[model samples]
Target: MGRGDKKSKKGKITKGSYGNARNRKAIKAKLKRTASKKTAAPADGATKQKRTIKKKAEA
Candidate 1:
């Protein structure tokens, strides 16, 4: 019939209730893991040294 009836048929509660703290924490942890993977920096330390040497040569 309506949206509520459809959800009930699927055995899902489409209402916003409290006590979702665990769900929120799990979502935040997942986001942090994904963000860390995307922003990973290079491990080699030579690039920084090369930049400094080039700057000194120019001066």
Candidate 2:
């Protein structure tokens, strides 16, 4: 198997495609990051600050 071999990593990269040869770690990591972000809770007082709207005086 050489660079032109489809089953090899180099071949996959040369072909600009992904499969079992490329290992799906990147996909798995992305999924984990998204899941953690969704399940993560903000600490007390760490939540986003509320915005106060100013009322204009009537002329």
Candidate 3:
């Protein structure tokens, strides 16, 4: 009946993975946080072009 118990009526039916629902939910939350935290630069390569041009002029 307990979440930590692996024994069942059919003799260790919960031996394989996905035995703990809480752990599975936590794993899903971690994946979602990492995926949504990604940031994208809206300016693309335009902002970096100015820096490279100045360097080329000095050389």
State TM-scores per candidate: 0.36, 0.39, 0.33
* Error of model 3, residue 29, in angstroms: 0.3
Write the candidate numbers in order of decreasing TM-score.
Answer: 2, 1, 3
On residues 1-59, what C-alpha lDDT tens digit does candidate 1 reach at each position? 33354334222234432134225466679999999986887787434454444445665
Off by over 4 Å in 2: 24-59
The per-model lDDT (C-alpha) reads 0.52, 0.86, 0.54
Off by over 4 Å in 1: 1-22, 42-59
Question: Which candidate would rank higher by lDDT, 1 or 3?
Answer: 3
Candidate 2 per-residue C-alpha lDDT over 2-57 given as tens digits, one digit per residue, 9 for 90 to 100: 78999998998888778998867886798999999988888774777799999999
Better of 1 and 2 by TM-score: 2
If ranked by lDDT, best first, what sequence of candidates would result?
2, 3, 1
Best by lDDT: 2
* Stretches of model 3 off by over 4 angstroms after superposition: 1-16, 20-22, 39-59
Predict model 2's lDDT versus the native: 0.86
TM for candidate 2 is 0.39
The digit string of per-residue lDDT tens for model 3 on 1-59 reads: 65346643222335445534436577789989887765544555544444444445665
